[model samples]
Every structure is written in C-alpha cells, then in structure tokens.
Target: MSFKTIAAILQGEQEFQRVLDCAIPLASRLEAHLVGIHAEVLPVPYTAAAGFPDTDFIQVSTELNKEATLKLRGTFHERVEDAGLSFEWRTLESFSGDGTLAGLPNVRAADLIVAAQRDVESDDGTDVESLVYDAGRPVLMVPHSGPILSSFRRVLLAWNGSREAARATFDALPLLIEADQTDILIIDPPESSDDTPDAAGSRIAASLGRHGVSVGVSVRNSQGQSVETLIQDRLAASGADLLVLGAYSHSWLRELLFGGVTRSILRSAPVTVFLSR
Candidate 1:
C-alpha cells in the first residue's frame, strides 16, 4: 500500500543533489528506507590505427572516475547524515559499457525508483529509459529543472483504460488517497459501444471514491492538438502537483520511431510524473 524501500538514481553532481532533494522528503513522508545508487563507469582503452592501446589515457580516465565516485559518496553520506533517515549507499562499477546499467539490480529490488527526467540537451550518459522499463517498478520522475516537490497535494491521473494505466493508478493509490484532490483527465477518449466518456470516467472515480479519495473526472476533446499538449495544459489549469499515468502503453519501438503520448509526456511534463509500464 505504501513504499517501503525507495531507490534513487544518482548520475552527476548537480543531478545527484536535485534528485536527493526530492527523494529525501518523499522518503521521510512515507517513512521508507532510502537507497542511493551510483553507477561508476570505468573508461576503456582506445586502440590506435596500429592497434596500440592508449594506456595513459585509460589510466587518467580511471583515476578521474574514481575521484568523482569518492566525492559523490562523501556528499551522499553527508546529506544522509543530516537527514537522519534510514538509508543505504550503493556504488556499482561498470566494467563493460553504459555504467548506469550497473544500478539495475538495485532498481529491480526497490519498491519505487526516483530519478530525474532525461535531459536531451546536456545528457550525462544516464540511461533513464532502462531504469523505467527494465526495473519493473513504478518510476517517480522529477523534472530536470522545476519546483522541488516536498509533498504531493493535488494529483492528475491520465486515464485511457489500458492495463498500464490501471496499474499506474493502483500503484499510485497511496499518493492519491493522501492528496487533497485527485482529478481524472480523459483526453480523446475512444468510442466504445459499452462505455461513454462520462461512464468510463465515472467507473474509475467510483472505484477511487470507495477508497476514500476525493476524486473528480474531466473529459477533454483535445481539439485536434497533440494529447501531450492538452495534458500539459490541463495540468497547469488544474494546478496538480503530480501526474499519474501508465508509461509506454503503445509499443516502445513504435514510440521511438514515431512519437507517442508516453514519449511526449516524458520529454516535457512540467510536474512530477508517476509512471509504470
């Protein structure tokens, strides 16, 4: 019903602090054990045209990565000490490739994973998609740069009647129940013989109401605009602090090639997003 263990992905100096800033308060609020995971990528030696390896470059890169890891660990310990919460630090060394992959084990074990939204502009080589898709747990993605979330009050649930949507809604029940108000926003609803827009929304609202959550439903037509645009507009209008939705309801490869709702939301949702695949 509540998060018992929360895993936070720490990528760089600035992002580490930002993710921790949000994760600390969330862990405190839920009284959950916090785990900080840092994946240290080891540099591989490059070969010259004649097949000679650049040993010096490799050695220097290794030392730099080690120093960075040490500094990050020290900062993590200091922050955890100040917070005085149940916490653990995990450091994984990447021997093969994409150091962030080393943290997958911790991600798999966690009840919830906290990570920063991907920054395509200044990417730090963190594979956030893998963490979300491969972890098999709900991911709480904080905006790369936005208002820090000390708590979630108003929540907006993006419902589309997919299994992923249902899972995300249930997974976020703890937050929904705790929120002052939760709005269900149905955009460009499908025309089904069995259910109308109002009927579909009412069914979910009634379920949430049974759990003692203050629930409201709104169906928007989107007016021929992208669903993501409409969702963002609604989010601002509703003033919801958190967004709960299923991730990648469509095929991942399809989304990667042709844009989909999941990709659009991940790239530019202003508020915190709770996503499960």
Candidate 2:
C-alpha cells in the first residue's frame, strides 16, 4: 500500500523543525497530503493562600501557550507552502499540551505517522509507543540525532516469524519495494516442529521478494548478546538507513516491568526506526 495521507506529529518547537525536515520532502516525493498537528496547553486557574485568584499566573500561562501555538502554526504553513505540497495544519488546546494526543483523530485517518525521538534536555518528546500500539497504523520514528535520509537505501528488518513481525514486514512494503536492499535479520530464532532452523526467515524473505523488495536473510545466534544490541550492530554494519521491527513483541506489561527490546531500541538507536503493532 502507498501513503496517501502523512501526519507529522510536531511535539514542540525545538524538534518539530527536524521532523518537518524529514516529513516535508517525503510527503512531496510521495505526493501525499501532509498534515501538521500541534497542541497548546490550557492554563488552569491558580489561587493564592488567601483564596484570592492569581491573575498574573493565569495570564502569563495563557499568553505563553498562545504564543507557542501561533509560532508553530506559522512555521508549518510556511514550510508546506514552500514545498508546494497539499497540506493541512491542525492546532488544539488541552491540559496535557500534547500534540500527539490531541491529534489522535487526525492521526487515525492518516495512512502513516512520522514522529521524532525524544530530546530530554529540551523536553521534545511524545508518547510514540501510543502511536505504534494505539494508532492501528505504522509509525516511523526519526532519531533526534542522526542522518535523516531523503530516501532509505538499505533496510534492516528484524523478523522472528511472530505475528507482530509479519505485520511490520507488510506494513513496510512500500519502502521495502523501493529500497535497494532489505536484510531480514532473525536472532536466536525459535526451533519449530514444522520448519527447520535454516528456514526461519526464508518464507518472509520470499514474500517480500514477490513484492519487488531486493531481500536477503541473516539468521544468527545471539551469542549472549541482547537482541537489541545485535540488531543495532547489524544496522551500523550494513549501513542501513532504516530499521523495521514489530513493536512490543512481548506482552506490554512484561516489557514495561522487566525491560524489553522495544523499549531499548526506542530509547536510542542510530538509524530511523519503523514500527507496527
């Protein structure tokens, strides 16, 4: 499937420009309708110890939010117009001040979502796992610091033959079809009664091959290395621009409590990561 509508979740000023740096060109190339979504925080009423309202606090908060909202809206429009792409700009005001959360309705309607990795120093972050798990769509996360390529030449697809793995592969078909090379990497593949160890990633490789993806498979023993580490090394070694994987292959609670591959990679990875639930 091709992307017809692309939503760029602009979390804040510091990082949204970088996200648009990737999204604008992609939308232009795909000829998709691009939507920029931002949300302003609604100030809550403040009261002093004497039960009197703090007008200064409320007014300052309100003005700051409005200023930020206006600034982002202006920048988004200017970039889209400069790119000459069909687009829409959405703005919202809510207590959470989360652009991603506020834009859920629009995000659900889009074919794909683009989000950025969090920059802790600047508080430029979003609940990206929600976008992956809740959006019922594929999400491409750009690293807060990395080389953002106009086009992905090599794709590293982590496959384990699980339902989630299968979902991510097909979801990434549009890019896989266009990529110069796609390596299906399976680490510590499970021993199956019906399939041999050597045949682990072959089926999916064949499936993607049929879709015009130049594909290959790499089955390896983790050798005491964590799955996330092995995957990271593979991306760097292969010079891959993209890493596609199933998000939360384990149960969400288990992953959250004990730590898991999804969380590890999401926290930091050198390449742009593509995820699907």
Candidate 3:
C-alpha cells in the first residue's frame, strides 16, 4: 500500500530541479528508492549534400548530448547526496527525442511515477503530456506554475463510478491514508439501477473510511458548466493541494471527438494532479 520506488522523469535542464523538489521529500517521507530518469536524443543520421553518411555531424551531436547528460547527472548526485536520501540515476538515448516515451520500461517497473505537467503556454515540453495515458501506472503531475507542495495534506478525489475512477481511488490509498482529509466529489450523477444519485459517493466514502481516511462526500450540480470547470472551482474553494483523478474513463476516440474531462484537467489543473488509467 506504500510506494517502495518512485521514478522521477527528468526532461533535460528545463525543469529537472523542480521535478526533484516534488520527488525528493515524498521519497524521504515514504522511505522509497528514488530513481532519476533522463533521456538524451540520439543524433539522426540525415544525408549530407552528396547523400553520404555524415559521421562528423553524428559524432558532434553525440558528444554535445553526452556533455549535457553528464552535467545533469552531476546535478542529480549533488542535490540527492546533500539530502542524504538514497537514489539511482538512469540515462537513455531516445530515437524519438522524447524522454517520457523512451523510459517506459523503467518507469513501468517502479511503484510510482512523478512527472511535471506540461507548461500550457509553451510548446517546448518533451512529450510530458502523453506520460499519464501511456505509463500504465499512477502518475503525480506537478503543476508547472504555483507553489510546490512538499507534502499532500488535503486531497480531492474525483469520482464518477467508472472503472477508471475505481482504479484511481485504490491507487491513491497510500496517500489518502496519510492525508488529514479527503473529499469525494461526484458531479451530476446519472440514475443508476443499483445506486441512487444521492448515494453515488456514499458507497465509496464508506469503503475509504475503512482505511482510516477522514472522508466526506459532496455532490454538485454542474449547471451547464464543464466538469473541469466545476472541479477547478471546488479545488479553489476546498484548498486541496492534490487532485486524484481517473484518466480517460471514456474511449480515446470518444474523448477526441468531444472534449474530455481528463484532457481538459491535464492541460489546466492549478494544483498537483494524481492521474491513473
């Protein structure tokens, strides 16, 4: 029920330090093995003027990437050692130039994955948006803006009675068990044959209560507003720092055709988000 190993996705020098700030303290609190994963893009063997293999271009590119990677490695050691926390650094060469996609195998092996949410204003992020859907593990996405949280004190769990929501609720058990309070939110619940709309969140609340989590259920009327909008409003009011969400409860095609809750939240969540598929 506790995270034994946490893989922090370090994407170059852009925000590696911020990612570490979120990962290190949590790892220390959980006493988990912290893994630092970074990927360097391999030089593409494009043709020269004469269409011959350009060795010089490849060699220079390789060296430059290596130099940057080594520097990042040094930074990792200096910070982690200073904290007196156990850690391991992993580096890989990605042909696709996407570290998040390249480190899938290693990330899958860990108990949890910590990633930075893509900066909504910039297009420079290295495929960080795809990590949540593809990782097959619960991902804690740190917001690119706002105050970084060293601990998750208040939590908000979004529930819709879907399989994805169920998976997310259980995946967040470790954190919920430690939180001071957890609120389950269900918006505009549909009529169910087995359960009533009033009790939509009640069942889940009772289940979580068994785990010793201080839990409460809240049902809100969306009132024509988007689900993401209401969720964000609640987050601001409740002052919850962490949001536990089930990603892609609907099909991929369905989400693409119509705007999805998962997609909207991923792009614009103000606080840290815990996403599970």
* Pairs of colliding residues, candidate 3: none
Weakest 10 consecutive residues of candidate 1 by summed lDDT:
95-104
Clashes of each: 0, 0, 0
Model 3, global lDDT: 0.87
Residue 56, candidate 2: C-alpha displacement in angstroms: 2.8
- Arranged by lDDT with the best first, the candidates are 3, 2, 1
Q: For model 3, where is the 10-residue window of minimal lDDT?
A: 123-132
The positional error of residue 37 in candidate 2, measured at the CA in angstroms, is 0.7
Residue 45, model 3: Cα distance from true site in angstroms: 1.8
Per-residue lDDT over 1-277 for candidate 1, one digit per residue giving the tens place of the 0 to 100 score: 8998999988787788888899998888898999988877778769867789988889888888889988988998888878888999988888642334787777888889888887768756456666667778999988888887957899999998889999999999988999999999998777788887667688888999999999999999988898888889999999999999898898888988998888888778889999998
Off by over 4 Å in 1: 48-50, 95-100
Q: List the residue pairs that clash in candidate 2.
A: none
Q: What is the overall TM-score of model 3 with all chains considered together?
A: 0.95
Q: Which prediction has the highest TM-score against the true structure?
A: 2
Residue-by-residue lDDT tens digits, candidate 3, 144-263: 888888578899999998899999999989999989999999999888797788878888899999999999888998989999999999999999999999999987678868879998
Which sections of candidate 3 miss by over 4 Å? Answer: none
Sort every candidate by TM-score, greatest first: 2, 3, 1
Candidate 2: misplaced stretches above 4 Å? Answer: 120-123
